[model samples]
Target: MVKEIVLSPDEIIEYIRTEVKVNDVLEIAYNRVFAPGIVLGITPEDEETGEGLRVGLALTGEILSDYVEVDFHRLKDDILEIRHNPTGDKDDEEHLIIIEAEMFDNMDQK
Candidate 1:
């Protein structure tokens, strides 16, 4: 099996444009999963960077086909569980990275 190396948010995005093997799920950010090319950039509220991402899956089912949104303003913790649906506007069946949100630790601060 190939070893999966953890990369930073910026690094992962760069990888997608250069050496992105799987478009479905690019890389795991702080905790939230990222789809790289899908998102324009991290949101402003995510400045703290202390969130939890259970999953950011790429929908492969036939039902969800036109759902394309990759939000990175939800990465906080160091654990992300991505679970997204499929992407493809009825014409293309290519599944790309989809935005996702989870838990953040900003509230548990001192």
Candidate 2:
């Protein structure tokens, strides 16, 4: 059986910090587009920057063009939806973070 765990913004941050690792697959949503990528690295939250956690991703498609750094603080405000372990592979459990589109029109506006 497969389990689908939906995560709130706060939980997403915590999940990334304690669970995510290099080479994980994450599909990030931006401007209504879902960009799949491999996690290249993760930088722990910086107190001075208050950036929460910075995730470096090597986006796989043409949409993003190149690597990008995702700031967890920004994601907290902008994230529409998150699904952990979408593939349901036991061996690769908790390695996938799926960002779906348009759960909220604009969280910042709310």
RMSD of every prediction: 10.0, 4.8
Q: Note the residue pairs that clash in candidate 2.
A: none
TM-score quality measure for candidate 2 = 0.66
lDDT tens digits, residue span 1-92, model 2: 33446566777788778877787667666456565667889999888866658888787776555888888777675666554443433246
Tell me the spans in candidate 1 whose CA falls farther than 4 Å from its real position.
Answer: 21-58, 69-110
Task: Report every candidate's CA lDDT.
Answer: 0.35, 0.65
- Candidate No. with top lDDT: 2
TM-scores of all models?
0.30, 0.66
Which predicted model would earn the best TM-score?
A: 2
What is the lDDT for 12 in model 1?
Answer: 38
Residue-by-residue lDDT tens digits, candidate 1, 1-110: 12334444444333333432333333333333333222222222233663321223354444543333343323333435332213413223244343232343788544
Name model 2 segments beyond 4 Å from true: 48-50, 62-65, 83-110
